[model samples]
Target: MPPDSDSPLPTDAELQILRVLWSRGPSTVRDVLEALDGDQGYTTVLKHLQIMFDKGLATRDESGRAHVYAPATGEADTQRRLVEDLRDRAFGGSPETLVMRAISSEDVTEEELSKIRALLEEADGEKDDASSA
Candidate 1:
């Protein structure tokens, strides 16, 4: 499904599993576990998925022995909610401040810098049009 820019965001763990589901689509616990980067066990991934289902973060298709789990929410919605939450908690509810902080954050890479530049250029063009109108 396409990301919904306005949906509720999942928690960090929920986001992690959701990312896996979003990328792979309706994965079983074993599938998710194997995809995880660390030494996470199958049971552990299954446990997390169970918690996610209970939290209404995901849903399962029980057509077979291995249940296929997928996100019950939209990806874009999740990302928007997460970014907004971080803006409130970490940047005092200012997206401008959050963007500033993120750009200045140690984890930012050259690709991210290019993305920010592109977004800024897009915004600038929109503003120019609005002013001319």
Candidate 2:
């Protein structure tokens, strides 16, 4: 049976395809295969696209032999959903804990912290606007 409408988050392979579609726009299996530098063959990419379509994570145009595929959702939407799922599953739904853990990582740079602060300020402004509405 095909996947349900509320299917689980994309697998790593599917996320790779989504990243390609997001970066390059709609593309065919061959396009994605060429873009990805992994050992996965053409058929593997084809199967991944098909599965993504079934799972409602991707859409395809079959008017031509080489069907063009694109992500059903935007990059931010997918990222938000993935992060929410991770927060729930691994962080006990505590976003503060998640953010603290993430920021504590050595890979996070000062520039990234500044960006995060800016985003938090923006979010606070939005919340204030919504409350006054």
Candidate 3:
């Protein structure tokens, strides 16, 4: 399903589960648990799955003994929501501020910087194309 822009951002724990589902597709509770490798027990994972289902962040298939879970939204869509939320709340809706703050950290790798540059160039090209059209 297309992501609902109105949906609230996923909590940290919820993001963890979403990440697994995004990467691995539909999975059982056992699958998520093994992927997490955290101290959280099976019951905790089950509870989170239930909460996610209720929140519409995930869909469940219960045709068999084990219910299969999958993300209701695409990874890119969710990431966009998360970034937009943060930009509005923390950067006064300034994309430049967000990007500057993000790159200010020394932990950002050279490869990451290259990717950012490439994305910026691509966006610029798109703008130029649009302006001339």
Candidate 4:
């Protein structure tokens, strides 16, 4: 399903569950619990899923005996939303500030730097195209 852009961002715990759902696809509560290494009890995970559904962060299927749950948003969409929020709130809406801080804060590998450069090039190309139009 397309992401609900208005939906609130997931909490840390909810993000963990979403990561499992994103990786494993729609799965039962038990499947999610197992994927999380059973760190939290089954009931805990189940409750989180219920809350996620209410918050529109996840979708629940009740066709089978065990309800299957899936992420309401794709990983990339969620990541983008999160970064945008962070940029707006903490970086005064400056994406360049956010990106510069992020790159400086982490131990990014050469390959990742290459990828970032490529993305910058692509974005620059789009900007150039827009200016000529």
Candidate 5:
């Protein structure tokens, strides 16, 4: 399903589950538990899965003894929505402001800078093509 523009982002617990589902596809509660931090309990994992299902963030297949839960939203869509939300809330909805924050905030190593420069170059190329067209 498409990420709801105004829909709230997943809670940290939900995000943790989603990262697993996103990377591994539909997963059982057991699978999620194994992948998650050892500090969390088995019941805690099941409880979070149930809550996520109720919240429309997940779907379960009950054909098997152990149900498999999958994310309803695409990972990219969710990430975009979240980054956009942060951009709006923390950076006044400006990509430049968001980039500035990322650049100025903690230790941005040369590797990160190189990647950012490449992305900027690609964006510039896209803009030039659009304008020229």
Candidate 6:
């Protein structure tokens, strides 16, 4: 199921579990716990999955003996939501400021910079096309 737009964002622990689910596809609580290297206990991971299901961050398949869980939203969708939330709360809703801060804070690779430049050019092209229309 797709996540509800109104659903609360995943907490840090929940995000970790979601990443595992995203990478491994649907899995049981044991599977998730093992994938996490048992950093968190079985019950802890199970509880997180239960809460995630309630929050629309995950879906559970209870048809089988061990309930299999999967992420409710795609990775890209989750990332976009996270970035948008950060932009609104920390950057005064300015994506440029967010991007600038992120680039300055990290040692971005040259290839990454080239990708960013290409995206910017594509955005500019779209803007010009819109204006021409």
lDDT against true structure, model 1: 0.81
Kindly list the per-residue Cα lDDT of model 5 for residues 70-110, writing each as its tens digit. Answer: 99898888888889889999988899889898998679998
Of 1 and 6, the candidate ahead on TM-score is 6
Candidate 1 per-residue C-alpha lDDT over 59-133 given as tens digits, one digit per residue, 9 for 90 to 100? 888999889999887787677677777888998888889888779988999998999899999999999999999
lDDT of 6: 0.92
Model 3 residue runs over 4 Å out of place are 1-3
Off by over 4 Å in 2: 1-5
User: lDDT by residue for model 2 over 9-127, one digit each (tens)?
Assistant: 89998998899999999999989998997658999999999989988899989999879998888898899889998999999999999999999999999999999999999999999
lDDT of each: 0.81, 0.90, 0.92, 0.92, 0.87, 0.92
Cα displacement (Å) at residue 68, model 4: 0.6
Q: State the TM-score for model 6.
A: 0.93
Superposition error at 57 for model 6 (Å): 0.3
Give RMSD to native, each candidate: 3.5, 2.5, 1.4, 1.7, 1.7, 1.4
Candidate 3 residue 65 Cα shift, in angstroms, is: 1.5
Q: Can you give the lDDT of residue 51 in candidate 4?
A: 92
After superposition, candidate 4 runs with Cα above 4 Å error:
1-3
Better of 2 and 3 by lDDT: 3
- Per-model TM-score, in order, reads 0.76, 0.89, 0.93, 0.92, 0.89, 0.93
Model 1 ranges with Cα > 4 A deviation = 1-9, 106-111, 127-133
RMSD of 6: 1.4
Give the Cα error of residue 27 in candidate 3, in Å. 0.7
